[model samples]
Target: MTDKERLLQYCLRQGDTHIIFGYRLGEWCSKAHILEEDIALTNIALDHMGLGNAWLERAASVDSEKRSPDDLAYRRNEREYYNLLLAEQPNGNYANTIARQFLFDVYSVLYYSELLNSADDTLAGIAGKGLKEVRYHYKHSAQWVVRLGDGTVESHKKIQEAIDDMWRFTEELFEMDETDDIIAKSGVGVDVSGLKEAWKTQVSEVLEKATLSLPDHNLSRTGSKTGVHTEHLGHILAEMQYLPRAYPDAQW
Candidate 1:
């Protein structure tokens, strides 16, 4: 594929991950255990949506077909999406949601940090703006992880379970494919594989502080980069795309 195509795909994947995870976090609207957390999660969800839209704009700018970001986000089939498997996983419980967010935020911080200096100006700009938000997101989720993991007996158990279940999917965040190879070679994409150790270190330190043990596993999940995703993505899309699909020509 051409560099434009690779860049477009890269932007869309990051955008999709932000949008999907934002939607999952939004599900906690008015549902968080405490009032402060309820508002905090909502605000964070908005940050994700805003970041996603920024990346979508980047994608649309470079797309050969000149597809609008809205069109790409709402009009594509599940198989056409490129969000990470970890982003698409169901938010089982509060702990599950926090665990997923924590892991993703850690990766996001590193990913954006590297992207801040990308040869592609658009990507670099987006990263520069997004890095600040992701840092805050990481802090929020990491604190929650520690709170739940090191809190009461029940809280500790549930958060530990979340850590185990979500850890397997973390591997995919660092997976590289031909698209990544081509884009990175051209200085527009990140070689995510190189970010794995740093991510592990950040996660390990947080888990230790939380009094949680990282699971030892040899297996990891993949395929979101290639448009394959878990069933949860379909459900998320169904809900997220419902209004646009049902009223294609309608506008607020």
Candidate 2:
């Protein structure tokens, strides 16, 4: 494929990833155990949505015939989405949710940091703006991870279980495919493979600080990057696309 095509596809994937994850996280706006955390999670979720909008707008510019950002995000089938599986996983307990966020935030910051220097001007600019937000997200989520990991015996146990349960999904965050290869060679997309070591180091440091143990299990389930997601994504998309699908052309 051509460079333009590669760039647009990369942007679409990034947009889909963020939009779906943001919509999921937004469900916790007023449901968090602590009011402060509720507001904080929603604020971060808004950041994700904002980033997704920016990337989707850029993607739409490249392929106007496909659909607008609204349609791309709200109208796509479950198998068409390119988001990682971890993002679609249910927000089981607070600890599990936090663990998921922490892991994603780490990868996002690193991904955007490198994307800031992309050859594609729009992609680079978007990454430049997103890097700041992701950095803060990492900090906020990391703090929570530490808090829960080291809090009390019960809290510690719960958070540790969350870490173990979610750890397997982390592998997909750094798995690269043919699309990634093309975009990375063109200097438009961050190389997920290269970011693995850095992500692991950062995660290890944070877990150490949290007094949490690393999972001895190394086996990881994969495939979401290629659109083979778990059963969870269907439900997530069902709820997320409900209004848009039911209303058809309705506008806000």
For model 1 the local lDDT of residue 50 reads 94
What's the distance in Å from true for residue 205, model 2? 0.7
Pairs of residues at least 3 apart in sequence or in different chains that clash in candidate 1: none
lDDT of 1 by residue, 1-252 (tens): 777788889889999999988898898898888999999899999999999999999999988887898998999999999998888888788999999999999999999999887998888988999999999999999999999999999999999999899988888988888888888887877889999999989999999999999887766778898899988999999999999999999787
CA lDDT, every prediction? 0.91, 0.87
TM-score top scorer: 1
Off by more than 4 A, model 1: none
Off by over 4 Å in 2: none
Error of 1 at 99 (Å): 0.4
> Estimated TM-score per prediction?
0.97, 0.96
Candidate 2: residue 176 Cα off by (Å)? 1.1
Local accuracy of candidate 2 as per-residue lDDT tens digits, 1-252: 666666667777788778877987898988999899899889988998999999988877877466788877887898878777888888888998899999999999999989989988988899889999999999998998999988999989988999899999998888877888988987778888999999989999999999998889997999876678889989988988899999998889
- Give the range of the ten consecutive residues with the poorest summed lDDT in model 2: 1-10
- The TM-score of candidate 2 is 0.96
